[model samples]
Target chain A: MATYLLLSTLTDEGRKTLKARPERLQEVNKEIEAMGGRVVSQYAVLGLYDFVNVVEAPSNEVIARISVELGSRGTVQITTLPAMSVETFVNAIKGGR
Target chain B: MGFYVVLTKLNSDGVRAIHANPDLVSAVAADIQAMDGKVLEQWAVLGKYDFCALVEAPNDAAIHRMAVEQESRGRARFTVLPAMDMALYVRLMGQSTETTGPHPWQIRWPVQIARRALRNYWIDQHVRAACQPLTVLGRENLDGLARPAIFIANHSSHLDSLVLHSVLPAAHRRFLTFGSAADRFYIKGRKGMTKQGWWNSLAMATFPIRRGAGRATLAHAEWLIDKRWNVAIFPEGTRSTTGKMSTFKAGVAILALAKGVPVVPVFLEGLREIRPKGTRDVAPGPVTALIGAPIRFAPATSVSDATYAMYQAMEALRLRLRAQRRPDGPEEAT
Candidate 1:
């Protein structure tokens, strides 16, 4: 599984939707799980970005699909960044992988 | 000198810049200080925004300049919301700070003398007019009673005060002061005593008793007791709209127990029919004031026990009054 950081910002319509039905957020998380992704940690942030989610998916393709599926709903804009542990990165740098 | 809640959202470039030099966070705080604003609290929170900052500045224009200066850097968007202290906000919304209690002058001799004059020439006539054919029972109960006692009664009407005053022994009437509702009688948060309040203080010998004031209301009453004056209180706190006796508040028990004074139960009957709660028109009906024997508590008696004893005494008097009931009058058939 690959780790990824998901940054999300709500659109005007998205804010209205969330304000009306906040439970839709948890529902979206369930949908992500159904698409073979696991949300590890998430925060409802205060600034330009509405959410910061750390997730695990089978591969980059699955994460990309998850982002596209969520963004297509017009409620949120998603930015996914693949993450590697420092240990893994250091090992790869040392030609140990 | 004003507070502002500054919501900041870091863009991609800003995040990269901060990642390169985390000291930029403290540097921004320093910048705010240089601009004559103090950053009271800053938190990197997880939610709709990246950071929330509470800042204090001289005024709105000063904070506006501070926000513009920070936003001009293109690092983050600043949403500055003006904030006011909750207490100041409530005060601005017409919250008052009036002290409503028994006035010091009410207990003075001059006021007492004036109150006696008002009661004799004006109030007694009004009471007699309002409660026609008023029957007072057990005046002999107070014949040899001690001074500085608490008169506890069951309240059902506004005329209760008038009737109670009319029936109190003439010797004690000059020294008797009644505990009246502060909210109803006193102007809240006013700078000076109101004219009506002065009239009540001089004429009715009434003092302000705030609801749920607990021991605070007892302070003036205790002072009056120490001065060898009687304090009459409706333990029910307010007139009962149901024409039934409401449960007595325990402040009377605390006052009586603390001062070691006798609790004299005076039950006023049929005043509700004359002028009950929330009505102005008087029916000019027959009313009875039954002054029972003074109740003295043992030194070791609990407050609840003393309160219950006072209530029971009043209840017993009420039952006795009911037993002697006739269509014409409440006078016993002796």
Candidate 2:
């Protein structure tokens, strides 16, 4: 499986939703797992993003699909980035893959 | 019961201790349970925070006490936020917000008689039961105090008003009126009264006070003062969640100044642990009501000055009581 980084920010409506139902944050993680993605790490942060999530998924398409499904709720906007290990990047450069 | 989100961050020492013995992490839940709180869900997540716990506690004071005890060991820092279910939050928002009050009939002779009977038999018993071994200090301050005085106290719990009423000298209790939150207690109706509002006014001699309504809201209070009714108000306006005195609102000052009445400052101790705001259950505990000497301003005292003076009076009482409670010295580990 490939690793991906997900950064999320909540809209005003999303804040209301979260304020009323904080458990929804964990529920969304369950949703991700149901879609064939495993949440490796998640943190409620205090900076530019409301949450920082690291997920392992089968492929880019799967992660993209999960992001789209969650963003459609209008409460949260998600940005996803595919991540590669430093060892793999160094190997690819050496082998000229 | 109140739901709380307790976000705990372990310090370096805490991290080392937990790393040495991971089972120590369960101590968080145990600490909460020790405080009569239930931990519903907790996660040791990887992030800026070490752990997040959803707990149910009787009130803010209980949860705060638990947090203080836990953090005093210098292992964890906690941030607690009160939570409500989504449905309950929406329903509370949908409640009527219009200010409708100052029911005139509440002061009628018949209604006053009924209020006295209710206070004597029902309300008094409940307060006495919940506030066992209640102590009233400096009540002689009210012995010969004039009628139409304003009794101002530091607000810490929902029990403040009830405790104030229960311990008051009978002479001052009669013809006493208090201000209740308009949005919380009253609903706008065609006749300016709802069932709950009617009962509150008749049973407690309460008139609605619209928050931030300014001098206009004090019209009814002024009328009460003219009728020689004593007014009891928590100048803090709202109950303190942290057992600290919030800034005193100027309403009490305004009323006392306009009516040319003295303001008696009463300091309430130990009520926050009994049944603070947002708690349904009452735990019987000892409570002390320390009444300060009446604060009478010279003629034409400015509103700001009057408010500050009144606040200082209550603050003095609080400090004096705290010093008395711990005669040696204040505890270093808060």
Q: If scored against the real structure, what TM-score would every candidate get?
A: 0.53, 0.61
Off by over 4 Å in 1: A1-97, B1-99, B120-122, B189-195, B327-334
Q: Per-residue lDDT tens digits of candidate 2, residues B1-334?
A: 5667666788999877776656576666887798888887665543455665668787678888989989999988987766654333433445555655689888889998888778756478878888878988988888788798998887877778888887788888887888888877776542443357877898888898888879998898999999889999888787776676766778988888878899999998888888877677899987888999999988789989999999889889987787777556434211
User: What do the candidate models score in CA lDDT, each in turn?
Assistant: 0.77, 0.78
* TM (B chain), model 2: 0.71
Which regions of candidate 2 are displaced past 4 Å? A1-97, B1-92, B120-122, B188-195, B326-334
lDDT of 1 at B264: 89
Q: Write one digit per residue (lDDT tens) for candidate 2, span A3-94.
A: 77676788998988876666677788789999999997665554456665668899989999999999999999987866554334334444
Error (Å) of candidate 1 at residue B132 is 1.4
Clash counts for the predictions, in order = 14, 0
For candidate 1 chain B, the 10 contiguous residues with the lowest summed lDDT are B86-95
**Compared with the true structure, what per-residue lDDT tens digits does model 1 show for residues A36-69?**
9998755554454666666889998999999999
